[model samples]
Each structure stands twice: as C-alpha cells, then as structure tokens.
Target chain A: MYYALQILIPLGLLMLGWGVGTLLERAHYRRIHRREDQHHHVPVTTERQLWNPDLPIAESRLVRGQVVVSVDYFKRFLAALRTLFGGEIHSYSSLLDRGRREAILRMREQFPHADVILNLRFETSTISAGGGRAMGTIEVLAYGTGVRYAQALRPPAVPDPAAD
Target chain B: MITTNIETVPGRTILEHYGIVQGSTIRAKHVGRDIAAGLKNLVGGELRGYTELLQEARDEAFSRMVDQAQEMGANAVVNVRFATSSVTSGASEILCYGTAVLVE
Candidate 1:
C-alpha cells in the first residue's frame, strides 16, 4: 500500500497541476481577448507621435501597468527537465506572452478615453532567486504616454462592464 | 515632479538637463509572504504579495531618484526606466534611473 500510495500521490499531483494550470491560462486568454476587443478604440503604438498628427492633443501623461505572475509547478518541472535536453521550453512561451499582453491591457484601462497611446515600452524581468530556477516569477511593466485629443474624433462608446 | 519615459516631457520645454540620476533599493520578502508565494506556484495565477512588494520597492526607488533630482534642482525626470535583479536568495534590487531636467 505504501508503494501504491507513493506512486499515486505524485501522479495525482502532476495531473492536478497540469489541469489547473491549463484552465487558468485559458481563462486568462479569454479575458484578454475580450478586453482586447473592447479596447480596440484606443490605439497603442510604439511611435512617438499620433499617426494623424491632427488630433490636437489636450493632455498626455505617462501611464503604466505592472503585473507579477508566478509559474506553476508543473511548468517549472517541465522547464527544469527541458534544460537537460537543451531545447526550447515551450511551456513558458504562453506565460511570457500573457504577461506582456495583460500588462499592456491594464495600461490601456488606466486611460480608456485616451485617443492613443504613444511611445509604448515593455519591460520584463524574471524573479527567480539564487537557490535555483525552481521558483519562477515573471514581472512585466508596460508604460506609455496616453494622449487625449482636444476634440472628440469619434462617438463615445458605452462603457464596458468587464472593465475593472 | 513630472516623470516620463519619453525623451522629453510633452507640452513642456526643456530649459536645461542634468545627466542621468539613479536610485536603487533591495527588498526581501518576509517568511510568511515567501511561503505564500511558494504555495501560489502550485497554481497558475498572479502573485499578489510579490506584486505589491515589488511595486512598493519600485516606488521607494523612484522616490529616491526624485529626491536626488530635486537636490540637483530639477523639476522633471525624463527617459525614466526601471530594472530588477535578484541579488541573493529572497532579496532583489529595484533600480530606477532617468535624466533630470528643468521644464517650463
């Protein structure tokens, strides 16, 4: 029974971690997609100035959003294992992508009415400590100058209830 | 003081610029928060404790940079940037640097 229990326990944990991690990632992506659609009006660009050059800016200021996401144990395990083979650890791709998009979305939410966001920059860093890569945390910070036009260029849309 | 990542603060004229000024701080999570973050790694989600702690540390670094700029007789900080690195187990450094300038 001890042997059976030992095998079953690790297997059970692996299954649980994999299941929950995928589900959480999917849910986060769903929310990201919905919010991306809802926030389509606000154009976030890397350029220093508005594309139109005729918006007549009323105000602009730096807006920033930051988030720290923890890597699930299952992914960390896979990543650690992958290190031996010395190949890509695909498990972390979506996590990094999610962090960037979420941070950008949060920045957009900070100034929803802005005509455009200019000069956007993304800063990302891993917060794994000295012991090993066993513990992983990803931090992404998105910042830009959100510009508000002097005059309304488009009809004001209804507020999104999904926005927080 | 106005702080921006862009080279120049919009709608403001740069009178003079002082070279780059910077501030840094190292923060270590308490035992409780560290344990909490470890448990959170079991599931995939945001680490609220680390988020708040890092942000708090970042703000403190920013404040120190502002203080330095203020002492240099600058009213605004431009081209601001933040970087983080793990210096040791449990302790990480938050560094903020920028150009200090007088703007009108």
Candidate 2:
C-alpha cells in the first residue's frame, strides 16, 4: 500500500507537471507565432502589383535585377518534430517571409521611384546536412528578380497566370 | 553562390577550403514515442525517425554550407547540391553544397 501510494502520488504529480509544462510551452509557441504573424510586415496590398490585375501589363527584354536572402537557424529537438507535424512550419515561413521582404525592400531602396516591379519571382529551398537522429537546423533561401516597369508601356510577353 | 573574389580568368576560386558543407542530426523520440516506435518496428512500417532526424541534419548542413560561403565572401550560392549517406543503421547525414559566386 505504501509503495503504491508513493509511486502513484509522485507519478500523478509528474503527470500534472508535464501537462502544465506542455500547456505553457504550447502557449508560448502560439504566442510567439501570433506576435510574429502580427509583426509589421509589408501590407499585402504592395504585393498585388506583382500580379497582373487586368492582363494589360506584359513586358519582355525588360531591365532585370536579382536579390538573394538566406537565413539559418537551429531548433531544439522537440521543435524539429513539431515542424513535421505542421506545428512549427509557421515560424519558418514567417522567418522566410521576413527575409524575402527585407530583400525586396532593399531592391526598392535601390530603385525607389519605380512604378511597378514586373517579372518578380521568389524561390525558397532547404537542404539537409548530417546523418544523425536529430534534425539540427533549418536554412531558408529566398531569391527573386525585381524589375521596374510600367504596365501599359511594358512589352507584350508571355501571359502565365501560374507564374505567381 | 556569390563570391567577392575577382576572377580575371579561369581558376578555382575555392569557395570553401573544406570543399563541403555538412549537416548532422540525432534524435531519440520522447520516451513514450520511443517505446511505440520500437514496438511498431516489428510490424515493419514507416518510422518517425527519418522525419525528425533528416530535418535536423538538413538544417545543420545548410548552416555550415552558408558559413563556408560567407567565409568566401559569397553573397549568394547557386547550383546547390544535396547528398545523404547512412552513417549507421539508424542514423544518417545530409550534406548540402553549392557554388559560391559573386554577383556584379
């Protein structure tokens, strides 16, 4: 009876602590995710120009520019698995988005008065490094071409809605 | 890959002296999950090991590759390559690399 009581009592306490810890961690993660999501990012309205609103803006042999941005981060073991389960993807996404935006902003800084940036393309890639049991970290690369052009004045080029 | 080195002609710029970017990962599941995985292995189905392990190694290797590129004054890496090898029965390594180049 004494053994059962000792073991059961401690086990129950452990379970309770674990549950609370999990709850706190999850809350923390969620809070961070939310704050990150809410972070002052470029308003979506800015990206709309990249999309052809009326199929009028098409250009070829246009001025071309490119920018590349990358971020490397290592997460704790548990966070790595949480990523596979779709729990931690948002964090990475946010990080990538932030990086891309900064890159674009830099481009814009280069050419501040441009009306529209045509032929804008963004690419992201990841690679694995070591043969081990735990996932060490994640590296994200974002690259794109930033162009300045006027829709009506731009040349008639390929129209691929799927480009976006 | 982008390198700041001025290559007037043809010559190996040597982006990274190591000639490799490496990422390694190790994972042991949560206690309960480990027990479950061990038991499930008997049934011969998908195991969660790869998911976690690969993710980690990939990240580490990527960081290393970037570090190497940075050391070379590369602003960007192009033509990236990825290779994997099984280090042990249950462990693996994921290495990623690319050409570091300088963009004008």
Task: Give lDDT tens digits, candidate 1, residues B8-100.
Answer: 766667999998999999998887887887777887778889888987998899899999999999998888888888788778898999999
Best by DockQ: 1
Give the chain B TM-score for each candidate. Answer: 0.94, 0.59
- Fold similarity of candidate 1's chain A to the true chain A, as a TM-score: 0.84
Residue B92, candidate 2: how far off, in angstroms?
Answer: 0.8
- lDDT by residue for model 1 over A16-128, one digit each (tens)? 77889888888989999999999888878888855665545666767788888876778877888999999888988888888899899988998898887878998888777
lDDT per residue as tens, model 2, A13-104: 54543455445435544654564454323222223234434433222111111222211222222345576686545434534544455434
TM-score of each: 0.85, 0.31
lDDT of each: 0.82, 0.40
User: What is model 2's C-alpha RMSD?
Assistant: 14.0
DockQ of every model listed?
Answer: 0.58, 0.05
Interface CA RMSD, all predictions: 2.1, 15.8
